[model samples]
Target: MAGAVTTVTTLSNEARPKHLTEPRPVRYLLIAVALLFIGIVVVLPMLTVLLEAFRKGWSAYIEALKDPDAMAALRLTLITALIAVPLNTIFGVAAAWAITKFKFRGKNLLVTLIDLPFAVSPVISGLVYILLFGAQGFFGPWLMDHDMKIVFATPGIVLATMFVTFPFVARELLPLMEAQGVQDEEAAVSLGSKGWRTFFKVTLPNIKWGLLYGIILCNARAMGEFGAVSVVSGHIRGETNTLPLHIEILYNEYQYTSSFAVASLLMLLAIITLVIKGLIEGKLARSRHGQ
Candidate 1:
C-alpha cells in the first residue's frame, strides 16, 4: 500500500505541469479563430471600400470632392456633429454626476431611461420626432403657426442625432466616477475649495480621458447616423442631406464608385476617432501608472 501511494503521488506531480502547459494550445487556437473572424468580417470589407474609392483614380475622386451637394452634405454632417456632441457631452456629464454622486428616489429608473436609446430602434426614435414636429402631427400645427420647423430640417437632424448619442458620455463616465468615489471631492471640500474649482482641478483630471472617449464615440455615431436622420431629413439634397444620406442617395442612383468613396471617407473618420481614443486612453493609463 505504501509503495502504491508513493507511485501515485509521483505521477500526479509529473502530470500537473504538463496539464498547465497543454492548455496553451487551446488558447492559441481561440486567438487565431477570433483573428480570422475579424479579418473576414471587418478588415476585408474595409479594404474593399478603400480599394473601390480609388478605383476611378484621382480625377473621379476630385470630381466627387468638388460636387457641391456632396460638400453640403459634409458640411451639414460636421455642423450637426458639432452641435449634438457638445450638447450630449454636457448632458451626459450632468446625468453622470447626478446619478453617481447623489442617491435619490427612482435613480435606477432614471439611468435606465437615459440608456433607453440603446435599446429603442432608431427608426422609432425618428418617428417619434416626426410625430411631435411634423406639420400634421401633435405639436406640428402649433409649431407651424409659430413659423417653426423641426422635422425635415437641420434642427430635426441634430435633435435625432442627440437622442441617439445621449447615453454615450454618461455611460462612459458613470462607472469611472463611481469607482473613483467621492473621497477626493470630500477632501477638496474639507480644504475649502469651491465647487467649480474642485471639479475642474480634481474631478476633471481624473475622468477627462473617459469623457473624451465618450465624446469621440458620440461624434462618430452622430456623423455616421443614418436611419433616424433619414426618416426625418426628407433627403432634401444639399439642404437637409447628411453624409450618410448622401451616400445612400448615390448608391440608389447607381453611383457605386462615389458611394464607396464617401463610405471610405466615413471609415477614415472612424479610424481617426479610434486612434484619438486610443491615445487618450494610453495617456490616462500612463498617468495612473505615474501616480
Candidate 2:
C-alpha cells in the first residue's frame, strides 16, 4: 500500500506542467515581488500617514481630533454608519436568503441590482440622490412645500451611504449561503422548527461569520465614503462634513499636519477592520474544518 501511494504521488508530481510546478528560485522570486508591491503600495502610504500625523507632536494630533468641527464630523460619520449598517444587514440577509434558498422570477435581475452600487461610482450614487431631492429635482417642490430636507442634509448622507455600501453584506452572503444550500433548513423544518426559528437556530448560526465579515466591510466603506457624501454634503462644515470630508477640507486649506492627523484615525479604523476580518476568517476556516 505504501509503495503504491508513493508511486501515485510521484506520477502526479511528474504529470504537473513545468510552469505549474514552480522551481524553488522561481517561487521565492514571485513571493519577493508580491511583498515588494504590497510594501510600496500599501505599507508605505500607511506609514506616511502616521509619520506626518505625529510630525508636529502628539499634542497637535490630540488637538486636531478634539477640534469641534472634527468632533462633529466624527459624530455624523458614526450616526451614518449606525443607520446604514443595520439596514443593509437586514436587506443583505433577506436578499441572500431569497436568491439562494428559493426559486423566484427576476432573481437574476435582483442579483444584478444588488451589484449596482459596485458598478456605479460613489459620486454618481450621491448625484442620484441630488437629482431626486435637490431644489430643482422632481420631488424638490414637494419637499419644500412640506419643509423637509433630504438633499445636502443628514438624511441625504445616510441615503447615499446606504446606496453605495449596499452590496457588501449581500455579496458576501450570497456565495456562502448558496454553497450551504437548504438541506439544513429543510431538516430543521422536518424537525418541527418554524420559519423564523429555523433561520435563527440554523441559518443564522451557519452564516454568522460571513455575515459579520460583510458587516465589517460595509461599515468600513460607509465610514470611508467620500465622493458620494461630498456631492450631497454642501460642505457645511460642522453640520454635514464627515471625517473624510473634514480631512479633505483641512488638507485643501493647507493644514497638512491636521489633515494627516485626521487621516491617521481613518487609517487606524482600516487597520482594526482588517484585523477583525482576519480573525473572523480564521475562526470561520476552523469552524468549517471542524464541521
Indicate which candidate wins on lDDT.
2
Model 2, 54-137: lDDT tens digits are 999999999999999999999999999999999999999999999999998999898887888888888899999999999999
What's the CA error at residue 68 for candidate 2, in Å?
0.5
Task: Estimate the TM-score of every prediction.
Answer: 0.89, 0.90
Which residue ranges in model 2 land beyond 4 Å of their true spot? Answer: 1-27, 288-291
After superposing candidate 1, which stretches have Cα over 4 Å from the reference? 1-18, 21-31, 285-291
Model 1, CA-based lDDT: 0.85
Clashes of 2: 0
Give the Cα-based TM-score of candidate 2 against the true structure.
Answer: 0.90
Distance from true position, residue 198, model 2, in Å?
Answer: 1.1
lDDT of 1 at 180: 79
- Go through the candidates in order and give the C-alpha RMSD of each one to the true structure: 10.3, 7.7
- Residue 3 in candidate 2 has what lDDT? 10
lDDT scores of the candidates, listed in order: 0.85, 0.90
